[model samples]
Target chain A: MKELTIGIDIGGTNTKYGIVDRDGNVVFQGSISTAEYEEFRDYFNGLAIALRKATESIPFAHKIIGVGVGAANGNYYKGTIERATNLKWKGIIPLADMFKEEFGIPAIITNDANAAAVGEMVYGAAKGMKDFVVITLGTGLGSGFVCNGILLNGKHGIAGEVGHTSVNPAGRFCNCGKRGCLETYVSATGIKRTVYKLLADHLEPSELRGISFDNLTTKMITESAVRGDVVALAAFEYTGRILGMKLAETVVHTDPEAIFLFGGLSLAGDLIFKPTIKHMEANLMPLFRGKVKVLPSGLQNQAAPIIGASSLVWNYLDNNKTQLQEEVY
Target chain B: MKELTIGIDIGGTNTKYGIVDRDGNVVFQGSISTAEYEEFRDYFNGLAIALRKATESIPFAHKIIGVGVGAANGNYYKGTIERATNLKWKGIIPLADMFKEEFGIPAIITNDANAAAVGEMVYGAAKGMKDFVVITLGTGLGSGFVCNGILLNGKHGIAGEVGHTSVNPAGRFCNCGKRGCLETYVSATGIKRTVYKLLADHLEPSELRGISFDNLTTKMITESAVRGDVVALAAFEYTGRILGMKLAETVVHTDPEAIFLFGGLSLAGDLIFKPTIKHMEANLMPLFRGKVKVLPSGLQNQAAPIIGASSLVWNYLDNNKTQLQEEVY
Candidate 1:
């Protein structure tokens, strides 16, 4: 019988859940609205009931091991959601404790980016890589850095927030109150902003000019580029160039084997990839030029986060052997 | 008998060597002129001969385990010095193999910054730290990053090159042919350059104005600052402010336990430290406030690189057995 674990990716808007096996195969999965509720506990309780109902159909032959959760602002050591100020959740909700109590199995919790990194390590492009960075360019840019096959958890559990780094110090204002962060150029909002800037400078026209800010999406821009819109393509090209240059600078410090691109913005193929590669090469230090490859993520976009969180549990089980020296002494 | 290792720190003008025991004690240590007149092999032969003469007088109680060499441009995996481009070494030289043959022990090699980081981990402030970044702000800015208690050696061995990252995109031209690199704002060269800029920008009279570029040393500037030279103090403050802001961005990524400062520029103390710490706190994400620290390296300036390189070999020996995982059948 294959060992299984429940994998959960808890986002600000939705909570995705899956039953995954050791090999990273998700047998069953579903999602629920996170914003439909008033309290995180109510949503969590509903999730527990849904998981129970889903597993009831499966035979006892499949042994369930543990559960792993990936939240936008989860903490691994404390096993709590550190009061995601954006969410309605009260201060320091012990999600792992609640999950363990409900499921009678161990539960591990980590931030979404970290979980995605683990998933990539276990079942994606970084299968054999010891050093790599998983970059998610979505609504806001997020990153997961793996150095020497181990995730870097800094003193305050805030490692790998690459998006916050200012690529253009005087350029754009970031939501974090910082100016000119990398996310300001590479994310969905970042790209849209860039598109508007390019439109102002160039004589090119795009289908996106008339679209409202609320309706302006990365998908619409990508589609417009596909349909031969110069302004849309220019936006992606400009965004990719900035991202690539910033990545070259990052390589000077972290020196990863590869940088795996994930999320919505990464889907723009040659529009983003070509310019990003070109700019990265132009900006890279000689020794690192042509050494680091930027590629798309290997895991299914929807399933990656959940599987990544699950992989964290698997990794913890594998590495946390309590060191023989600790027992011997 | 305790194990002994020969540690060597090779500089452009001098080479420092020491016999270090298992507990990080330097039993016998000394320096020798590199004597640029000789060929690579001849210089190494002389070095080995001098080392042999020193060991002969110490009554060999512990067998030498290996030799660890730290050079400005050493490559750990290749065990070669790739033409020490910054120095007079104009051709590729296999320093490790040459030392191994002469000393009859395994030889390991790494860049000086990496060695200093290892030194800090083994015998300095980062003794028990699993995550930290060590910055050596000398003629150029050099960095060594440790994550999960292991050095971050990226795909091309140039992982910790934080100095090359652009701090101010429009600031100044860099030695690496880039504009506004972090090194352009924070290194010894950076501070001097800043002083020159300050002198040109303001109608200030200071001891530094008469000093030529070649004669304007960090020591002279720092001494002037201590005696209430506004321009000199302002240069340090500006340098520190830029460094602290950059460090804040780094904290968002690596979340290091502490940042250990090493090399010549670090001696500036509160002149640099106060502004650096203030800017870091001010620009830091709220989550990491009052958590991460920036401190002086505990390893003595002279001993850091050699001991750090030796510590790498020690770590390799200690973890070699446990690092390998058995293949699942």
Candidate 2:
């Protein structure tokens, strides 16, 4: 029988899952509305149903050996989601335990960014690379660091919170009650924030001036930038400049060979890539200048999260081979 | 027969060396003036003679297994010192190869800070910890990062250059032509600079005002602070505040369990430690708050560099056990 794993990505709005084989092929997939289930029990029940339906439909149902979950604030060490602000659950939810009980398989959990980093390592751009960083640029910036070929799950399994690292102590205010966080100036919302600031600061005429903050999106800005809109181009440049400086600072901590960009904003392609690379090189210490590569995630956009989630199982098994073998027998 | 290793620490002014046993005990020690040799060949010859003389006097000379070197700008991978500004040599000096050729033993090299980190891991405070950072606060700031119990040597073998990381983009001018680097605000010279700035900014009664910038030292500032001089107190407070903030930012990157402070400035003790810990906790993200400890290095002042250098050989042997075993046989 072909071995497979069930990968689940739990987001605020939707929960995505798929039956993925060892080769990263998605045999079957499904989704459920996450916000509809206000209670943790209801969410778990819904997840169980979705997972079963996806797996049962596949021809190789018994081949599924394990389950892996990727979620916001997921703790790999504890297998719990601790006070995730976006979720309706108020306290720690033992999601991994629920999955293990429901599926009768080894289950593992980690934060989405770490899952993404594992995905890159197991099946994407960071293949065979021991030291690298993965930055997920969505509504907020998320990061996962791989050092010496292991995920840097520091003392508390929250090591790669690069987005929260302050770039300017007195700069922009962040949702996390801190000022000058890297995320406030580098995410998709960050780009939108930059566009609004640019529109307010400079009177330069451009297509982005009329869009209000609530209606504006990074995608629209990218389209405008492609069309040669001055304000949109400037927004990307500013965002990239801050990101580059932050990455340069990160480089001194753990000299990553490459920093891979993942998630929605990365789709902007060269609009974001060009300026980020330029500033990263400019801000780098002389020894690291032109040495580190800024690249895009190798996984497809929609499937990247699921793939990342799936990789957690393989990683867990690899690290716990002796215990896993005993349990299997 | 007991096993021993020769540890060499090459600084701008003096080169310190010692023969150390497996238990971190120094059997014999000596020093040579580095400035006396302008030519690399002359320096190597002098170093060979010094090593011979030091080992010949020791009772168990045949028991020495290997040699380790710690120097400014030392590259672990290349075993060379590249363009060290303080040294007379202008280009890459193959120091490790020279030691290997002269002594016919396994030799290794790494920067002093990295050596110090390994020393802490093998024989100091970080004995059981898998993740920690060692900050050496001397004339300049030097950092060694240990993640998952391995020293973080990036792709170029020059990771953990935390001193160069910018805290404030426009804060202070650094010797490396960068503005607002952490070293510019946190090192021995950094405190001295802070004292001068404080003198110019405040009209408070301070004995420091009488001293020129070149004459003022961190030691003198500490002495003045001990005497309840307001300016000196404020300088320490300011320096601690900036260091705390930078460390908090560093926490989000690798999430070290504890940050160990070593070198000259660390002698100020609670004068620097108290404020730094307070601000580090205050600036930390809620998840990391009260989680990471700010502590002092375990090694004594005079022996830290030599011990750190010695650790390089042990680390090298551990990592290259198969090759080392083959060579030994």
Best by lDDT: 2
Off by over 4 Å in 1: A200-203, A321-329, B35-39, B169-171, B321-329
Q: Pick by TM-score: which candidate is best?
A: 2
Local accuracy of candidate 1 as per-residue lDDT tens digits, A1-329? 76788899887778888889889888888888887889777888889888998788667888677788877667877788886644677678888889768877778887788888888998898998988998887778888888888876666666777887777667798877778888889998899999888877877667777887778899999999999898888888899999998888777778888998888899888888899989998887665778899999998578888899889878776777454123212
For residues A1-329, could you state the per-residue lDDT of candidate 2 as single tens digits? 67788888888888899888787887788889989987889778877777777777877435787878888788888889987755789788887777767766777888889999999999899999999999999878889999989988887777888999987778898877788889999998899989888988998998987888889888899999999999999998898889988899999888899999998789999988998999888887776788899999998578888889998888777888787556544
Query: Candidate 2, fnat value?
Result: 0.76
For each candidate in turn, the TM-score is 0.94, 0.97
Instruction: Give the interface RMSD of candidate 2.
Output: 1.0
Candidate 1 C-alpha error for residue A95, in Å: 1.4
Worst 10 residues of 2 chain A by lDDT: A320-329
Q: What is the CAPRI rating of model 2's predicted complex?
A: medium
lDDT (C-alpha, whole model) for all candidates: 0.81, 0.86
Candidate 1 structure quality by residue, lDDT tens digits, B30-147: 8888756367766787788878976775655757777888787788778888766355656678887787677667787888888888888877889899889899877788888888
- What is the DockQ for all candidates, taken in turn? 0.69, 0.79
